[model samples]
Target: MIGWREGADRVGDLRGRLLDRVGTGTVDIDRIAGRTLAEGLDAPRAVPDRSHSTMDGYAFAAGDDYPLAVIEADVFPEDDPPELAAGEAVRIATGAPVPDSADAVLKREEAAVEDGRLTGPELDPGTYVYERGSNVAEGERLFEAGERLAPRDALLLGDLGVDEVTVRERLSVGLLATGTEIHEGRSRDLDSPMLANLVSAWGHEPTHEGSVPDDYERVESRIAALAAEHDVVVTTGGTSVGDKDYVVRALDALGEVLFHRVALRPGKPIAVADLPEHDAVAVAVPGKPVGAHAVTTLVARPLFTGESELSTVEATLSTDVGIGPAGFTYAVPVVLEDETATPLGHADSALQVYEETFDPSVLSSSTRATRADGFVLTESGLAAGDAVDVVPYPAVER
Candidate 1:
């Protein structure tokens, strides 16, 4: 009987609890993408550890005027050139270390070289010179704890001489889709595949336990066994208070039910349970496709990634979206176009799969949920031009 607000608040608690039980592993920086940072990473030393020249040119004391004697040896990236004496300069290439006596670099194009002498326009000190540790200082925090590693972030870490990083081990999730209809092939078990892909996209391993029938004993045995084998167990269907809903009953008998329901339209039947016997947490999402997707993104994703902030974007609604019978909040799918969030199937909508209806009932079907790129959550019906926060699909950008 929890309200949507309370349910959403509890999501943070669930995330903290799950993350506390998760394990950590060391991974090569190249393979660390999508993994959670178990500890904050700091720059061991300043990047570009030494002062260097940024252009292929002549390096000399800024106060040295007129023709300066060019050093016999050229300074390349790997060479350590001798210090410039009075009225002396050295030919330095880009990325080459600057001699301690030099404070400025004159680009080759700007310098006049003749007969072992080089001359250039007088410039201020430090011009065209890259100072030591300019990019990052020593011991600066590079990434905070709990940050999810992105590919680019890993690349940057690699550039900083970090070959490996400690990251949270990816969890092994057991996916189960419940319903006698699916078991009998009367209805296709779409939830299993969808949930599996989502779990994979979130950097976890998904072991599809297959669809379970409505029998009480089988449900109990399947859940208990999967819980024993996996770090987390996720089931779709049999969460609501229906005569055939044996999943919840089995979970209640086998574990501690953290919460049974959330006040959310198309997804109110969500449930979470802690199975201490198997050392795993079990999450039950609604059988309806959109409902399952929403709960997984809002609740399950944070648990896996250890992210506290929900991802969302602000956009203007293109048309009036009804929210009648307003006891529950709604996840209204919409197509974004030209910075505006047009209701699905509108004249200017960007997505082609949207139907004209805004009813939550349509989301109950597995296929209809695919018709949206993302959705807007609102407690009251939205009028045209109202600004709303849209949560996109966790893996898809558009």
Candidate 2:
């Protein structure tokens, strides 16, 4: 009786639970990218650490206009400037520390020197001078616990002089694709490679255990081995209640099924389970390519990365898309063009085969997948010109 909405909610809950249970570890700044912090980071001192010049100009005390004597030496960035005495001016370059006695800097273009005397416009206090502690104050919190560090974020931490950070350990995922056809090489194993890419893109390590046949013994044995070796075990195919579906049976024998089915198209037979003996979680995705893609995006993404929601954008539908059942959610592939969502294939179709009606057999058609940018999910049919939420594939950067 689990609907798509409820299933999504459970997946979100599972994300939180897994992070709480998986624990964390310490890593150097170079290796911290894509890792979430286990603890908050507070700056012990301010950035820049001292006052300096922001312009290539001359540093001096500001006051009434004066024909002052310019110092013989020019100040560079690394120089330790001597204190400025009354009516004295020192030539300073950009990023050079301002002398303690100086309160302003005049742009070189604004000032002209003749002989030993420098003449320039009147200056205000603090002009062209970067103040100490302006960028970041001492003891300020930079990042909170559970924040995932991107490459730029990690660089920022390094700029703050942080040598190392404590982060949650990356989960190791095992991918197993099940089906007799796949095992016998009659059908190409597509889901395993796709899932591995997805897992890696989400910042986790994936170990593809390859395909297992529809036999219960093989499925059970593979699940046990994978679960014992990985933090998460993901399987594609054999999740439905059909005669050949052995994933659920194997899961029941080794652990507990948290949820069985979702009220969704293409990916309705998805299943989730937790294996206590192996300290791992198992997820089963439908074998159909589009279904497996949707399920992985909807379930595995949040489960492994701790993301609350899929990144989505609003767009206008270029054509009508027929909804499935009134209560079930539908996933429709579309090519986004200039803010308009063009639904792929013919009208009211969930599965778009090669120039024909949606057939499960054509689910492995790579050409159809390449035609669309991403898929849009909706609970009701969308008419042309209607605004809709489009969930882009992870491949799309934005």
Candidate 3:
């Protein structure tokens, strides 16, 4: 088995290969949220375009003597600022472009205007002024290729007069659950709906292609059909080496299995493959619900989102949690409170499946473990009060 980091790296490599075949398109700024930029974007023009007032005050050339002549024309946001002569000031509202000669703006309340003359405190150059190119300079790189665009990015793009952007097309993913229990209605297919939600959250289109029994032929044929219909096929369950576990075997027969398993506890059975014949990729997740979620977010996520880094929050461990194995990296679920993380399956937690040592096997199947705020990935045991980096669900979910 390989390490989880290597698994993520392989998934990232798959992302690059998939991107080359997916293509790109132009999208309006309104519809660009959650999309990846296909090419770098540079500022066409400088922000503010020209020097403008940051306050509703008077614009005057600094270093001029007191009691300067006040210009009659007031500058509004839409009006062209009238030229100011030496020892002259003009009324300027907030966001109004300052005259070319003006270098400072004095607040209205601070200014003394009497007998068509203006007097204010001593001013320095560029005070109370939004300087030209201060926000964004022309030819400055605004966004780089492969950066995912968020809704907040629209504010900057719209201010820069960018109405649309070029972004890579969203991946079309098909979710297939494999299990005799699920196919026979004896067990509910929990992983498919969750995987579909995850795929959608990762900015991809996910279709629940339904489930197939443990039969190798059925699993192989269904996977092939799904691969033909989607850019990616995500199969849940039947990833282990058991006789009934046929997802991995079917993938091996249909394509090239990149990696069979990772050294991740509860989620080690996850597998990734390249289905070149169908021009698609396959990700086989373990049957365990928690393990399925953990591995997909840590490994398969990069294939769709093009991101490998985990955003984490530092917290104090509330209790000592021991790992059964030293070689595998364990993802221990925890509930966060006041910067303290309490392992979810601990004796003190809501789910008491273990005393001190974490029971990943049982915790992976516990539905209550889903209430965890985040998880701590560690290879060794964690002592109480130790500082741990918790990867929050929100950080990976969307």
- Point to the candidate with the largest TM-score: 3
Ranking by TM-score: 3, 1, 2
Q: Model 1 over residues 223-313: C-alpha lDDT tens digits?
A: 9999999889999999888999988888899898888887677678888888877878888888988777776666555556655365788
How much is 187 displaced in model 3, in angstroms? Answer: 1.4
- Give the Å error, residue 105, model 2: 3.8
Q: Least accurate stretch of 10 residues (summed lDDT) in model 3?
A: 14-23
Q: Write the per-residue lDDT of candidate 2 for residues 87-143, one digit (tens) a residue.
A: 889999999998888889999989888997888889899899997788889899999
- Candidate 3 global CA lDDT score: 0.92
Q: Per-residue lDDT tens digits of candidate 3, residues 1-398?
A: 99999999999999878877787999999997789999999999999799999999999989899999997899999999998889999999999999999999999999999999999899999999999999999999989988889999999999899999989989999999999899899999988888988988888899998889989899999999999999999999999999899998889999999999999987899999999999899999998999999999998889988888999999999999999968999999999999999999999999999999999899889889999999999999999999999999999898
Clashes of 3: 0
Best by lDDT: 3
On TM-score, the stronger of 2 and 3 is: 3
Evaluate model 1: give its TM-score.
Answer: 0.85
Worst 10 residues of 1 by lDDT: 345-354
lDDT of each: 0.79, 0.79, 0.92
